[model samples]
Target: MDKPKAVTAAAHKLARLICSMLTQGEAYTDQGQVCCEERYRQCVLNKLNKRAQQLGMTLVPAAPAAQAG
Candidate 1:
């Protein structure tokens, strides 16, 4: 939960992933920031939607605003 602990946990996970790739003779492919951010956004949305359903509510997307000339 705290910064140090979160960093350590993430480092451990990355180490394990790298080890796995090395053993499997696989190259690491970077998904890039945009892909990672989209995945995280979708994950958060899924959690929010689930909570809303539990509270007898629903989540809706806002309408796109019109472009100003």
Candidate 2:
């Protein structure tokens, strides 16, 4: 497998692990102070962005907010 493929696979695996942890309630404490959701989100996003960069893809900017009428 090539570097890109390896990176993709690793990223996917990491995402799945994070999801499992969250779903199984293994990611946070009762008081919600130890929430892992945000950390997981950032980790996945960072990995995806890194993979995109490695594949020569441009990371798009966040969409603009809509104005309420």
Query: Who wins the TM-score comparison?
Result: 1
The sequence of per-residue lDDT tens digits that candidate 1 reaches over residues 8-67 is 999999999899898999998888999999999999999999999999999999999999
- Best-fitting candidate, scored by lDDT: 1
Q: What TM-score against the true fold does each predicted structure earn?
A: 0.77, 0.41
Q: Report model 2's TM-score to 2 decimal places.
A: 0.41
* Superposed model 2: Cα runs more than 4 Å off: 1-34, 64-69
What is the clash count for each candidate, in the order shown?
0, 0
Prediction 1 TM-score vs. true: 0.77
Candidate 1, overall lDDT?
Answer: 0.97
Evaluated at residue 40, the lDDT of candidate 1 is 99
RMSD of 2: 10.9
lDDT score of residue 37 within candidate 1: 98
Give the per-residue lDDT of model 2 (tens digit) for 1-69: 999999999999889878988889786335464567877888989999999999999778799999899
Off-target runs (Cα >4 Å) in candidate 1 are none
